[model samples]
Target: MGVIAMDKKQITLYYSSENSIGKQLNAYVESSGKDHLTIDISKTNVTGTQWAELADGLNKNISDLVNTDHPDFKEAYGENSVDLDDDGWLKILNKNPSLLKNAIVIKGKDFIELTSASDFKQYMDPDSAGIEKPY
Candidate 1:
């Protein structure tokens, strides 16, 4: 487990502000009024160990955290069945964080990879806690 992956009472968003989806995700989380920590990977450097822990926390392979179809990825490594182990994939992430697929929201001991705005409910469902409308 990553030491940084778990916060006591806040949502940790690992994302790049350079993308539209990421922007929307940030806004949604902000609107929730929950305490949050945003890590803009584009400007921040996440260590290899932290990245590995995040991947494991999400039950995914390190390569699965990458957008292999991204232009940068395609340019650097053509889609020629390039296979890499965990450490090898971590190197790619360490060197080029932009290739990351999506935001990773870590809350408590749980984490989810945000693919779209609709995915927010998984972490923010009001009914889960029986939070009624103020009406």
Candidate 2:
């Protein structure tokens, strides 16, 4: 009998701003040979619940990679500004949405929401992620 191999897909998260945790995550995902995806929420409108879902997916992805025995996972996990925990994940989601929501709400505009991990990851350039060669 032959064993079947599942195709591994990498997810990358990108943000327009620099000097933020999202940038660090982008670097991490790229170095890990994972698929690159980006979501530009800068001009998009999103609901609070949608933001929460995106954050949850990111949190889960990081957790899964870190828990694996992959060497690069440790470095990637450590590079984040937010610690890996349920509360921490929620904090990130809330903070990001709140930051955008507050500005938009005050101006009576809609805020952008990241719906899913894949939605965000689709924007990253694979080469930029630095995952060209497996370690």
Candidate 3:
């Protein structure tokens, strides 16, 4: 099997300024000395292709991409009704991007969610987490 290498330069972030974790991620990326494209889903729309790319980066784990705790989601479906398949979650996110998780950091073909400020440091300095760069 051929191994795929990561292109660190091809980094993108989907984040919201309204969330603390997202705000911290934005600061980290700005100072991390890496080139990146930042998207605030609250103010802009993501195309279907872009959504697919984001989903792929998450290994198609739609639960990780969604904020089930968001009031809009909770009120509409109740707490236990989040058993959505990939397409179902994507459809919801397409209609309501604000319900997306705080921040998604896409580096090359891989991605990690910045759920907290500490997650930023852990993902950025992967060696400390006993993780090697995916290649």
The model with the greatest lDDT is 1
* Per-candidate local distance difference test: 0.80, 0.34, 0.72
**TM-score to native of every candidate shown:** 0.83, 0.28, 0.74
lDDT of 2 by residue, 1-135 (tens): 112111235342424332244444445455756454444344334444544444343343322221222234335345444356655443433334222211100001112223233423433334545522332
lDDT of 3 by residue, 13-93 (tens): 788776677777788878878677778777777765676666666676666778888988898889786677767877887
Candidate 1: clashing residue pairs, number: 0
Better by lDDT, candidate 2 or 1: 1
Q: Write the per-residue lDDT of candidate 1 for residues 1-135, one digit (tens) a residue.
A: 346847647888898777788888888888888899888887888888788888888898788998898989888999776798888887887778778898899877777788997777655775644422222
**Which stretch of 10 consecutive residues in model 1 shows the poorest summed lDDT?**
126-135
Cα error, candidate 2, residue 74 (Å) = 33
Which residue pairs in candidate 3 have backbone atoms (N, alpha carbon, C) closer than 3 angstroms, thus clashing? Answer: none
**Any runs in candidate 2 off by more than 4 Å, and if so which?**
1-8, 12-19, 43-49, 55-135
Clashes of each: 0, 14, 0
Candidates 2 and 3 compared: the better one by lDDT is 3
